[model samples]
Target chain A: MDFAAIIGNLDLYLQGLWVTVQLVALALVIGLALAVPLALAASARRVWVNFLPHAFIYCFRGTPLLVQIYLIYYGLGQFAAVRESFLWPVLSEAYWCALISFALNTAAYTGEIIRGAMAQTPAGEIEAARACGMSPAMTYRRVILPSAFRRALPAYGNEVIFMLHGSALAGIITIVDLFGAARIVNSRHFVPFESYITAGFFYLCMTFLIVWAFKFIERHWHAHLKPLRG
Target chain B: MHKLIITAFTAVLLAGGAAQAKEWTKIRIGVEGAYPPFSSMTEDGELQGFDIDIAHALCAQINAECTLVPQDWDGIIPALLARKYDAIIASMSITEERKKKVNFTNKYYQTPARFARRKGSGIEVSAADLKGRKVGVQRATIHDGFLTEVFGDEVEVVRYGSQDEAYLDAVSGRLDLLMADSVALMDGFLNTEQGGDWEFVGPPYTDVKYFGEGAGIAVRKRDNDLREQLNAAIDAIRANGVYRQINEKYFDFDIYGN
Candidate 1:
């Protein structure tokens, strides 16, 4: 393997890394924003309230991300109604289609993660909040959400990494993320090992950064829960 | 019991008949149904194109029944290697790199690579002229290789999974230019309404170092006999004017380059 081939195209690799970061960051923010409401609705007491969110979760989570992206990017474009619609401007672009698919896909998984953590909220904490005469909204805001998020952090961090990896599929729709960059280099240079090994290293570094960041956040938020250390 | 015994005897006779001899009576040929002029799907879900016609002609000459298998371009070769199909009639150029993995027959047709841009774009198709411009091409193709090799440092080469996607980007003005097989560009894009505003720019590039020998049917390396049969069939079709009939159905000029 010629390591110099990889080193020579460092700029292209970095550009790919940047695209991957942008895609993951934007998709994660959108997904998390959607997941909070989705998880809350999915956990609602009323069957009617939970039905749609449950269906949404099942539909998005059950399907492959590649299919979802293709549906958004290609299938939608096939219809005249979609082309003539007001949202055609946003729906037509590959970047937005990829972003929308990634966001919806991660939302289903993240919603489940948050819902699981919320289910584990201690009974004593809820009783204490009720005893203080806190409103249902205030009780959830001050006590439940904070605690649930802290507990959900570790699982959510894994979702973040998965989303980052899944962002590689954006290349299929013509977005030049890290994987796309590696493909371009590989096709051009005809050196699969050098090109992909470089991309793998970049992905590894990103994964480590995500893990480290999550560890720091866990330390800060779960400080009281930590056992005393020497 | 008498009926069961009769059924068993008949089944044994049928099995013996089926085991008598095995010959190349049927062949499955892979094609990328997305590449237009060469191969594409009609609105009625039928595969129709020059490549499909050529496959039919070749199969007829070889006296074998042909089954066209629709495959994505990226996985077409690997699928052939895995025996998903007996041969690939896809417009895959014969290259040394690909030859290392799969064997190819003699050229069925050859075409040069060219760049297309929106009509009246006033952009020159030179390395210095395209510096920092975004050019779209299908990923993992000879055109992609040529662009990257020639202008990797000078231009931004955006890769797509399919030529159709690159054409879409070019139509939407996301790409300043698109590079692909000249005949494919003509039949798949430039001649269509979506590409009405686009025109071919720059000279046709046929550097053997990159574009390879020509488009050929690919088979597994072990299937040399099949490869030879395909080459003979290709020659038979060309000599008998069947190749010209299919060629005229798609292009005005001969795509079988010198």
Candidate 2:
């Protein structure tokens, strides 16, 4: 194996790294926005209120993200009416198609995390808020959401890492994310194992950063829960 | 228990007979939908161009109903091997390295590989000029392998998943030059408004090392019969002028095996 060939295109590799960061950052923001409402509705006790998002979360989670990207980019593109529709402008670009798929996928997984955290929010705390004459909306806002968010942070961090890796699929759809850049290098060089390994190392670095961030958050959250003896 | 065992044996035998008698009424032919003028989808979502037309002619010749399966180029070879499709009619070049894993028919269409660069880009127009400059080609292609082997590590190589993507990037000033077949580069960048933006810069290059003689129908190596059938059909099409008619529809000149 020629080490120089692997190390030669550092600029291209860095550009790919930058694109990957952009994709993950954009998708994560949109994913969190969608996840919040879906998770709240899913945690609702009313059957009709919770059913739709539950089904959505299940379907998105069940299918592979690769298939989801294809269905969104190529499968939906097969329809002439869809091509002619007003939404065609957004759908025409491969970047948006990948973003939509990653956003929806992350939202499904994150929604479940948030919903489980909400369910674990103490009932006594909610009852105490109600006893204090707080309105239902106020009680949930002040008591439920904050607690659920704190509880959900660790799991949400893992989802963030997964989303970063998943955005690599954007490479296949012609998006020049970090992985896409690496693919370009590999294609040009015919050195798949090397290019992909370098790309994987970038992902591993990002994964470590994510873990560190979550660890810091966990420590900050538990500061008030320390034992009196300690 | 004896009666049940006899009934099970009879059922297994009947199922095996049904499996053996199943005829291939419908066949799937994988095409790279991104290679325009060869096998590309239109803005209106229809699969059009040369490969689509040629596949129809071949299917009629073989007396088999065929469906054009749109597969990504990188995955096309593996997908064919995995039996995701019965054959590949994509603009797949028949190379010796590829021949070890997959079989190919006689050359259906041959377009010499050319270097494409922006109108005034100082990037080299020749293989010797390519030293130290960045060039892009589609991955897993004979062109990519050719450049790597011939140019060595001196030239920077960029890979694109599809030809269109590479062209867009090259036009956007991301790549110094992009290389692909003359027929595709003609229909892709040269035939459009961007035709002025990019032009073929180098002499057409062809050899076993670079272009692999020409493009052909690709099937699994074990499927030698399918390879023979496709080669025969291609020969028939060429003899009757059907191949030239289809070639001239997309290209200004004939691209059928020079």
Candidate 3:
């Protein structure tokens, strides 16, 4: 580890850190928005409706994100029609392509977590809502969702961290994220181990912060379960 | 309804499987996509520039089915040895370090190495000037080996994964000087801001002692017949002006220095 090289390239490294944070933040927000409805649809009684989201979740989760990124970015570009389409503008940049892939991947995992939590929602509480003449939509919105969010917090936290780490793949496609900057530095400096290690240290710090935040959220959600001393 | 849907889905799956098995028969040609003007993917998702066109032409000339497999530059040789591809057409320089591991066809394209510093930075280095400066060169390359031999330990050599990144950092002011093939450096300078700011310093240095004998298509060591076939095709192309046509299209002039 050349401490001097790390110190010398500190500004570039910091810029890379900010890009990574942006990638994760944007991906998580979009992923969560897509996941909740998919989770609800997957648990639906209709076979056709549930099958659509189930297959979506399975396909995204099964393949490596690297392959997905390439397919979306390079493979899609091969079609001239795609280049002429409305999506061409949005898909033209590496950042948006990576963002779309990461968001879709996180949605799949987060959906599964949410589905599992929904399945565990106490049937008796739903039954009580029905007796009170509450509409199905009201019952889910006022009761079921809050409980499922609490139940899904820990697993969802893991998904958040995975999405954050997976954002590193953006570097391969030329997005100037932390790993991308490290790769550039390593190429210039010829110290792969040192450059990558510095990037990893920053990622570790970010991961630790994420973990700390999620733990606090978990504690807050579980506070109701704590027994009061008589 | 469910039964019909299941039956239709099954038929579609079978048809898709059969189609994939028959379409675009596999012929793997390895490439280092990190090298632009060769096979790098642009930010907008195009696997284009030069080597791609050349590979397509070669496949058509040989009447062989093919696919271009993108591999990292460092592992390209090892991957070929492991039977990962039928041939390597990356902008790989034919060097002694690589020749020990793989055989080369006759030179496909050749460009000499040149030095660059930020334009007007007044940082000029003659062959004698690199005695004790930190120099950046792409790793596992003839250029890096040449610098090591010429400057000895007086030069601090840094190896990069690709020429593009090396030039990028040099442009960003991370390195004092960068060394790469004239063609690659030219591509960088023409396509990038860093290239605009960095001027090529000194005359290009060539020959095996410097830039090696030029770039060639790398085949397995044991594939003597394939090598002969490739060499013959390259010779035919050169004689018929096909090589010149392709070369002229992408480069400003013929880079296969005499």
TM-score of each: 0.76, 0.62, 0.56
Lowest lDDT block of 10, candidate 3 chain A: A184-193
Clashing pairs in 2: A16-A178, A184-B159
Sorting all predicted structures by DockQ, with the top scorer first, yields 1, 2, 3
Model 3, span A1-230: residue lDDT tens? 46676788899899999999999999999999999999999999999999999999999999999999988866786676887788977786667999999999999999999999999999999999999999999998988889999999989989988888899999876576898888756644545577889999999999999999998988899999889869
Ordered by TM-score, highest first, the candidates read 1, 2, 3
Winner by DockQ between candidate 3 and candidate 2: 2
Cα TM-score of candidate 2: 0.62
Q: Give one digit per residue, the lDDT tens place, for model 2 in B1-258.
A: 999999999999989867634544567899988988888898898898899999999988878899888998876776787789988998888787677667888888888888888887766665577777767788778887877787757687666678877775565444677778877888877878756688878788888666786888888776666777788889888888888888778877768755
The sequence of per-residue lDDT tens digits that candidate 3 reaches over residues B113-132 is 88777767666675466666
Highest lDDT scorer: 1
Once fitted onto the true fold, the runs of candidate 2 whose alpha carbons sit more than 4 angstroms away are A1-152, A166-223, A226-230, B1-25, B126-132
Chain B only: TM-score of model 3: 0.83
TM-score of chain A of each: 0.96, 0.94, 0.97
Off by over 4 Å in 3: B1-71, B74-258
Give a tens-digit lDDT track for model 1, residues B39-123: 8999999999988999999999999999999987766765776788999988889887788778899999999999988889888
Identify the runs in model 1 with alpha carbons over 4 angstroms from their true place: A1-18, A33-64, A71-97, A104-124, A133-138, A154-158, A181-230, B1-25
Candidate 3, residue B29: Cα displacement in angstroms equals: 19
lDDT tens digits by residue: candidate 2, A15-122: 888888877888899989999999989988899999999999999999999999989876777676887788877886677889899999999999999999989988
> Where does candidate 1 chain B have its weakest 10-residue lDDT segment?
B16-25
